[model samples]
Target: MSDAPTTYTGAVKPGGPADVRELGGLTLTKVAVDAQMSNNCYLLRCRSTGEQLLVDAAAEPETLLPLVGENLATVVTTHQHWDHHRALADVVEATGAATLAGEADATAITEATGVPIARTLSHGDTVAVGDCTLEVIALRGHTPGSVALLYRDPEGTPHLWTGDSLFPGGPGRTTTPEDFDSIMSDLQEKVFDKLPDETWFYPGHGNDSTLGAERGSIPEWLARRW
Candidate 1:
């Protein structure tokens, strides 16, 4: 949406990155497809219960259907970025899954994907699927409505599906005067500082990382410091 180059673009391959890992009894799969060449999506499944949550479906519905099976509980968009919501309509129609995005993203989601969102989410809201719970954390640097999902494992390690908010080595860009300060401060205090050191980061567009790994990069964000 910011004219930034899209990342994932290619034929819909059957398998994703071979090294897909299982954490906290959930199978995490990354689907890298679409014109942006971005990490178009992620499928989080509870291995024991079989319930699933689809995060940021970036391609057409048909392209994502094979990757998502009958157990999908809901589709949650991290933000209203075009690459992230391009396939919203198809997914909703195909799975009949309720779509949820940040409260501020509902309008854009409806406009871009032509589908009325079933619910709006905000910080602290919890969406439950099977035995897993995804707690919403508003992370608005990249976009006004961007949010992250936090899942705490039994061992106390937190797994974050940080849309485009906090990436491997840097936080998402703050493109305007109003969003630059408030969002960055919120991220540092509310997200970065609060997350445990061992938290795993499953971002929207890259290889997975850990909170400790990203913590080392905070200094780089000094230039954008509020």
Candidate 2:
């Protein structure tokens, strides 16, 4: 194991509304950028191995590029959405990292980003960065191919980077008529019920919360589920 420290720093663009938070570790730097007041884009770095992972490359690659550069190893999208993929082409150009998304959304991601989908991911796949691993969990509520990345801190507490699955107060929106029930069912059975109460949720939008907080809001969510 490397003996590097995990440090985080935040920076805001001069004329832009986005804020970039750089979390540095022994081998990786996890950079989270708050974009368009709602979406988030993350960059994971492996210092020892020089491998990096870019999660949900949203708009403003001009703002996100210097941090990503040649160190990027792969780009993984939680799901394919306009706001999330708008900056992908710039990222691909800068890092040459293979872009990955769910099989169900690959075509849409490709169409939206104008970049080929290099790999299709499914539930239970492990995305590795040096010795760290993020296990994929298909949430499938907000979008057909929506997924969550589950990782553990040194203490073993679960930390989830849910693309658009479960947010601070609830899960993401379901526009397709066929996805409403599946999205809610998946939330209750796969996400809310399966993960421990202590799991920290880093959603695609809003502030971070825990599974316990989200579980408590299920009734409120169900009441509004339409």
Candidate 3:
């Protein structure tokens, strides 16, 4: 509904889709797209199987296509926000990969992007990304159905892809007090309390942060009440 653009100058280096970074055993590639809003799209590949999972097709299908490669197994839309799905239609059309999203937002995502979501995900659901599985952690509030994807490596340290729910210093923006309360409660119980301090969260936009780094700011985030 809002077309306000956002940017993260230092959080991530905006690069072409071909750039790939190592994340423990997996390969993580990120590209920052500047459109109505600046959104960070990520592609995660299983090093062993070489299968891929595309996260948030924010914009520019041409750029995303190369990063996605030929073994894309699933395309995940973090939420139903327009900004996040801008490139979804084209990317899905090209890849023919299965699309997955939270059940509550599936209809809206389909209506907005004109791309059918192949599977509906809920809290505790696991999606296979090659040899690794991404566990869905539903975080309600930003939308009635926003969720975070978690992939735990062999060492137990988790990598989280959070879309507009939990951020670096605080929770995502909410329009009303009830929505704020809902997000705050879920984040406290489902995320901050449940996930380990070593868990690194990659947000939809901007920089990534760890639970350990943000643990001390919970009280401040709560006190601000925004």
Candidate 4:
């Protein structure tokens, strides 16, 4: 606790120089990758035993694999987007890690990545990384099976990994008004309402933002319908 990082900036780029944050029992590393997508990837390692789990093996495996050292226990694809899973097959092959994803998107992810999901997560389900636990939340838009992972530390503020579902300024892009409404409703209820304002969220494509920072803009987000 004394040596833990107080906050995570979540700014990163492809290749070297990942942003690392040491929470109470979990160590989080964020890397922004390219294929020109500016996609984000997260590595969550357990402090006690070094059991590692990765979220979105987006791209640039050479840069990401070393960050995990060896023995990555699991990889979770937040959704079935091609950009978000560009390196999924390579990562799973390299580490022999079991994969997880939202139930609705599991088949699509397997279709895209050629790697099967060992487990399909649903809303309220939990993912364990060593001693820490991440709660799965179904966001239901931007992609049919989009999911966000929420982790609450016993001694710190909660953190969320929102893969293309919600971002700093607004909800993730949707193709239609109906899709926009679906994502927005989930954000308002499953995310903004259930979680506290102090919760820090990591988006799939950009810098980190807190629920408190974006809460006031919900009305504007609704008006714009993006």
Candidate 5:
């Protein structure tokens, strides 16, 4: 896999393929697989312990397995979305890594893939990833149990893994008015209103973006109501 020039602490150039970048003490390896949709799979590793976390088993397990290394500690599903878990079973089978998902969608994700969820996470819960920690943030509306993970470096800079909840230009696809409103509320309170401008966000699909670059478009996204 080629290394993308971008990193959580640096600017991202959209359309980059498989790449590995550093985030202080952690290493984030990204790969965009062509599946039902353009799904981005991330492998995060703690430099100190080599314990790794694989975020969103999107697709192409054969390709992802190598990047994930042998120290995988957990395989976390962002939501119960089929596209995001197409390769979940494969990766888990290969790595024997514990599976995790939001409590609400835990059963569905397990039933659909036959890869039992080892643990169900709730909002504000911290997932121990080797020497590092990632906080869970529930993001509903995309899927009833959608979630995003926030990893704060030693310097306090935040790096979020937004699984189809908040994207570059707007929130994820929500059909009904109620669903749209729910997602919008989650994005506002848990995201925009809280995180710092320089926080780098890695979405489930496509390129990554910083909070500062996306904050200005909230009003426009609201006006569009998508």
Candidate 6:
């Protein structure tokens, strides 16, 4: 076995210590940058090619830029939310990295950040982080274009970036019953049904949780929709 850390605790705080986890051929770093909202930004690096990808520029460009160094390949916005891309313009300008988001929310994200998305992603799209690829899962409800990224580690468990869609307790906060139902349905069909219980997921805010841990709560989440 390698000397790298085998266990990952996905906890982070504002101006964070930045929890990091090592997987086969990949390293995952989670940072909490937006102090007010406590938004989480993830930095994924490919050990073989040294290419990096940032998920959600969120806020605090100064805090994010140094971690980026000189080799950022792409920045993917999970949704068109303002808090999620607050530092998009700054980060992209500093790194000249390509920008990506779900197709439906591309225009809104550009409007919010003044940084046009280089490519609009879809439910089945694949994003490359050097040699490794992340499969995109479009989950509406939190936002019309909210999306999630799934990474299947060859030597470990499947990892997911859930954005603001699914959290530890239940699905994210939705405005109306319609929106709540929409997210719940997508989470059921696309995420819970398709993925294994062992899959570990990182959320957009707060701590992380696994599918196995949250599986039993689905019924409760449905009964008491928020």
Instruction: Write down the lDDT of every candidate, Cα atoms only.
Output: 0.75, 0.72, 0.82, 0.88, 0.85, 0.92
RMSD of each: 6.6, 3.9, 6.2, 1.5, 3.6, 1.5
Candidate 2, superposed: residue stretches over 4 Å from native: 1-37, 176-178
The sequence of per-residue lDDT tens digits that candidate 1 reaches over residues 67-92 is 78666778999998887887778877
Model 6 residue 186 CA deviation in Å = 0.5
Candidate 1's error at 211, in angstroms? 1.5
Clashing pairs in 3: none
The 10-residue segment of model 6 with minimum total lDDT is 1-10
Comparing 2 with 4 on lDDT, the higher-scoring candidate is: 4
118: Cα error in model 6, Å: 0.8
Which lDDT tens digits does candidate 3 get at residues 1-226? 1111133222554453333556545777767786446688889888789989889988878778877867788899999888888889888888888999999999999999889999999999998877888889898889888989987766447788999998888898888889999999988898888889988788988877889999899889889996
Regions more than 4 Å wrong, model 5:
1-17
What is candidate 3's CA lDDT for residue 23? 56
In what order do the candidates fall by lDDT, top score first? 6, 4, 5, 3, 1, 2
| TM-score of decoy 1 | 0.86
Residues 15-101, model 4: lDDT tens digits: 547888987778888888884788889999888988999999988888778877677999999998899888888888889999999
Ranking by TM-score: 6, 4, 5, 3, 1, 2
Among all windows of ten consecutive residues in candidate 3, which has the lowest summed lDDT? 1-10
TM-score of each: 0.86, 0.83, 0.90, 0.96, 0.91, 0.97
What does the lDDT read for residue 152 in candidate 6? 88
Q: Candidate 6: deviation at residue 70, Å?
A: 1.4
Report the candidate with higher TM-score, 1 versus 5. Answer: 5
Candidate 2 residues 159-203, lDDT tens each?
678888777777788876557677778878877777899876677
